[model samples]
Target: MTRRTLMAAGSMGLALVAAPRALARRADSHRERVEDLIARMTLQEKAGQLTLFNDPFRWRPGNVNPGDFDTDQEKTAQQIRDGHVGALFNGIGAEQARYAQRLALEESRLGIPMLFAADIIHGLRTTFPVPLGEAASWDLDLAERTARAAAAEGGASGIHQTYAPMVDVARDQRWGRVVEGAGEDVLLNKLFAAARTRGFQGDDLADPLSLLATPKHFAAYGAAEAGLDYNTTDMSEQTLRGVHLPPFQSAFEAGALCTMSAFNDLNGVPTSGNHWLLTEVLRDEWGFTGFVVSDYTSERELIAHGFAEDDRDAARIALTAGVDMSMQSGIYLAHIPDLVESGDVAMEVLDRAVRRVLMTKAALGLFDNPYRGADPEVERRVVGSPAHRDLAREAGRKSVVLLKNENKLLPLPKAGKRIALIGPFGADRSNVFGPWSIFADREMGVTFEEGFRAALTDASLLTVVKGSDVEAPLDGGIEAAVAAARDADVVVLAVGESHNMSAEAQSRVNIVLPAPQQALAEAVAAVGKPVVVLLKTGRALELSGAVKDAGAIMVTWFLGSEEGAAAADVIFGDHAPIGRLPISFSHYSGQQPYYYSRKATGRPELPEESEYKARFRETSNTALYPFGHGLGYAPVSYGEIVLGSETLPWDGELTASVSVTNTGDRPVDEVVQLYVRDRVASLTQPERLLKAFQRVTLAPGETVEAAFTLTRQDLLFIGRDMAPTVEPGWFDLWLAPNAQGGPHTQFRLVR
Candidate 1:
């Protein structure tokens, strides 16, 4: 039925929610009892419960199924009729989901309900800031709220499960899809992952507004070789569990429903087919019982990893290794039965997998009410709704990173200003949309022109110049752009990679801008006018050349549809930009994975290194813009920290506070970070580890004390034997915005 017809029909979910106390309890109470029904089902029926095939009706193919399935339409339909297919993916719109539900309930022998899952990563219909961009906000509460908004919108659009809050700690800029994760900060990753999971799976699972949270690519896929997407990840075991594993652990603790395995191999083993990662680590130790689902045909891709010989072998290995769901990769359809009959895979294993899947559906209130998501009216009213867009705009505002403001060049004056907005990235809607945005309304994206238009009530004096192409050089357009830049009072050049430049499979050799584009930027800077460079892309680009002598610089990843307005607002003093860096920006591309926290290499590189030291010839190990680096319209001066407890036992606690003062003419936000360094511990240890952080807003010249409390667990690390423990020794504490800064105090540790 159409949205209008459904709304007019009216006797739907609201009816159940608004019913009388006794009758409402009786009808809706059945949702909580869905688990009992699944418990009584036979093994064959239980396997059917976990089997979610694609519903070709409304959820049309974005691409063909992962190689294991028969790509032909007739074969796919026949499988659904075979009564083995359970849930489906990418089916949007209520009518389509309802139709799929009808097929499962009416066509299948068991009349089971199909669980609908989709990649509602950031925003479902109304696109929000990319996860990495959102990480710049460093607001866990906001992250959770954004997840709720996404879940509501996705659920309203007939999406039951959202593959979201991709909590990978991305350090490499070459991986284009690192846009989906928080970059290289364990504390940042944990906070956002926990927030998103809680938001996706809200207080009540039975609420139709909630969707199951699938925090994914279950391991350190972000550290892929040379930062290449879908490439093998090799890291020390200590780095893996301590740095990369925290986000997954936090997401799991927040009650995530499912976890999707990564595309890359762990060590030499493909994650989808690795029993140790799935069973020994995730389930047995970490206690992740919700379920493990393979990424889009990841099992079939194991052959490409050189671990499996064929699709069948890949399926056998993955399923036996603890993968419960075969997403898009149709390997199970062709081979699971044979493997079961051959006694290579036990029926009990299948039963346990099916049990987990059914448990999730039951938790979602899907089994009792097959028509859970069939509300066409709610979909129309709430799809791309105003409230959701406003949230997107809020997140956009928070995602902006104001990097440099020479002599306070920012908070650009709105009145009496000849504003020249130059560069190819300023007007492109697609680049701002970021990747994995399946449903992002590119047409609706607000461009920099829109931002400028909205900020300048009367846009009579604003000049525009497409200075250079993002993917290529603007060989012919530079002359006109230079003239405009020279004529204007201030120039804002928006430049970065094109829309498809920095995501999955989008890794680069240099991790720098195209040489021609760099030359174009130099020609513009030659105009000798104050230039403000605003970067728009997924990963960090080496900006030493562009930044060589720019008046001001702003680092903004694809800032969603509302970013234009937010950027303009910050530029013109309506809002002081407070966003910080989520990933480290290196001085050059060679110092990649150049995070603030890392084990000091035995041969550490310095300006003048000793013969016994490890160092680099081409470059230094310093990043261009350090993590937690962002400039506001105002500057905040930090003072010395005071610690309450200087010596503490293993189980003792300590309280610390650092005073900060906004010593500028405008309001701003400051992020105070607390870190601890083990004076002497294992042979391999990072110089320091981030323990706590806080973001406090201050008015012009205002001051505040940021406080942090620490427990012994905060000092613990995964030992050489892989045991989480705290070593007894002296420790140094550093309280700073960036890692390049020195420590606040040195304290002794009691045994």
Candidate 2:
């Protein structure tokens, strides 16, 4: 179904508007129970249901430090017992969650079970590659499996909900939060959103292993001004609808139980209090019935944004704007009751928010079993299990992008060859789990040295040297690295940003290798040994000098616990590098917010054009490594694009097909991407828009036909009136390996 169809057909809350009789009846039953509870609740209790608190004593299994305790633990605990807090976050451990749930159930007047939430961005314990890196694999099933595994582990630890699968369409490599999302393409973001939602919630939310999936930072958090986090975003409504809103819509359609409001302001309004975004679009348009929760202190930040007068005004505005819950902010608890009593905020509005929260808890089966899925035994068996580790290894292996392979120098021999593994990250374990990995254990991780030792029969053949710190010089480090490189037959230089460098609040202006690391790379390359640059990063960094000029370059973007083994697998040819770049890698840092789907300019940059054209003097207009670009052991070739017909009926469909062949001797996986562009439209369209993609495995000398079905729905775009429209016109199509150059054809949409 098209997005419009989904928007119209979807229902609010846990059940469809047009659900089956049995489902409708159950939903009615849940609503009745919630209504009864709400009617008995005092204004303070109703407000409390919309307030979420952080567990001060974040108790873990057998690991509790008194110094790390929240000094306000007594106050928070009393508030919970007094029915002033309905949810808790930042605490893991089945027993701890059970204790908190018992306090709410047994002590509170209403006896409502408390909800538990956490930032399960990638994984709970068995850390997977960062979400951006996972997107590089272009494997929807892999994304789903990793999410499912995380849900199981998190569920076992009594986490009722996970703020995950950040579906923001990020184009700015400098933005630290890009590491948490799929890259710039809306199509990829949409697919991954649905996959992760399905994986986390499974077929039923009541399932013991299922987690309430929250597709978060709702609407355009990625388009921050100058690529800075929490900055204002001023764009035309059409751009918002076309670029930013699609993924959130897609996630809602995929049955995400909840969503978190973004921190940034859209246009002139803060997203926390933007009624159009939170109510009109999310509810009336998309029919997201699940509750909307504010980001950490975002509701209170409305004052900082100058959108609200005070804490009371912030609480009133957020609730009226359709935000059902306040996270890590006491504003709601402090003023919501007074606002309701004084007729500033309606009782109906307050009740509606409370009802939504209650319904969500009911959907998680918390009403039936307060301690559901919080089993200490299950937690012990599941989190960081061997099975999960194996999945992480597979995910990491597929996420490794082979950026350059000069003369096919990779697939190094496993034995006899002397290998020098140089750089700070060669054996570093502190930064493998990229970002938002609160529960990740560095001790569980395998280092590059350990992976090499496990792979090689003669461990003496490999030498590891820390050439430099991530951003500082090490004493005599470069000299030792050079000596090792000279003595070895091959050198694997691992270098990139630490885990802390590419996450929230860590945006950088100079997005390249540190000066010391660059110097180390140049010195090591001067040794004249064949070098493979094993780059570990969270976001795309501009490449230059000897590191970029290395014989082989592999981008391993902060692969998690099994990163080392995964890298060893790719280096030893056990697994071919099948990952593609989800985002563009630019030649210079000046190209902030660069993407493949940019609208065509009046004066386009062309090789044969004059210097006055849209060309940059410092660097090339194109990316160093374009989106969807990657290399494998075996190269794949694409044939001419074949269309079903030159003209397609306005209401009819057509097929775009291409024959892709594995031309080399080895088997390989190839991602065949399909893109489209309208020749003319009411508004200017992007030069090319990614529509469909497929990952196909081809054996040596084997050819396979990859096909995509195209309909008017596929051509739909937000038009002049800010609604989805498809105008009859000629559309260009490309069936290629990546977003850049491909075999092209055209089809006309005729009335």
Best by TM-score: 2
Cα distance off (Å), candidate 2, residue 454: 1.1
What are the runs in model 2 whose C-alpha is more than 4 Å off?
1-27, 60-71
lDDT of 1 at 80: 59
Q: State the weakest 10-residue window (summed lDDT) of model 1.
A: 10-19
Residue-level lDDT of model 1, residues 1-751, one tens digit each, is 1222211221101111121233234334553454465555554455455555555667443553334333354555555556566677776788777776777678876565778888888887787888988988877777888889888888887878888879888877777777888887777787788788889878766577788889888888888888877888887777788778878877776777689888889888889998998998887776665788888878789898889999889878998898888877667766777777788788778767876776666667776676876899988887788998888888888888987889778878887889888888767676767777777666778888888877885687688788677766665778878888888888888877775786667788787766656776788888788888888877887886655468888877877778788788778878778788888888887777677787777677665664556545665677778887887877788888888878866667677788888998777888887777887886566776666677888888798987776666677777777767766788888888776673479777787
Model 1 residue runs over 4 Å out of place are 1-54, 59-77, 605-612
lDDT of 1 at 589: 77
> Whole-model Cα lDDT per candidate?
0.76, 0.85
TM-score of 1: 0.92
Kindly provide the TM-score of model 2 when superposed on the true structure, using C-alpha atoms: 0.96
lDDT of 2 by residue, 315-425 (tens): 999999999999877799999988988999988899889988898887777877788867899889988899999999999999999989998898888888999999999
lDDT of 2 at 691: 81
* Residue 91, model 2: Cα distance from true site in angstroms: 0.7
Residue 362 CA error for candidate 2 (Å)? 0.8
Indicate which candidate wins on lDDT: 2
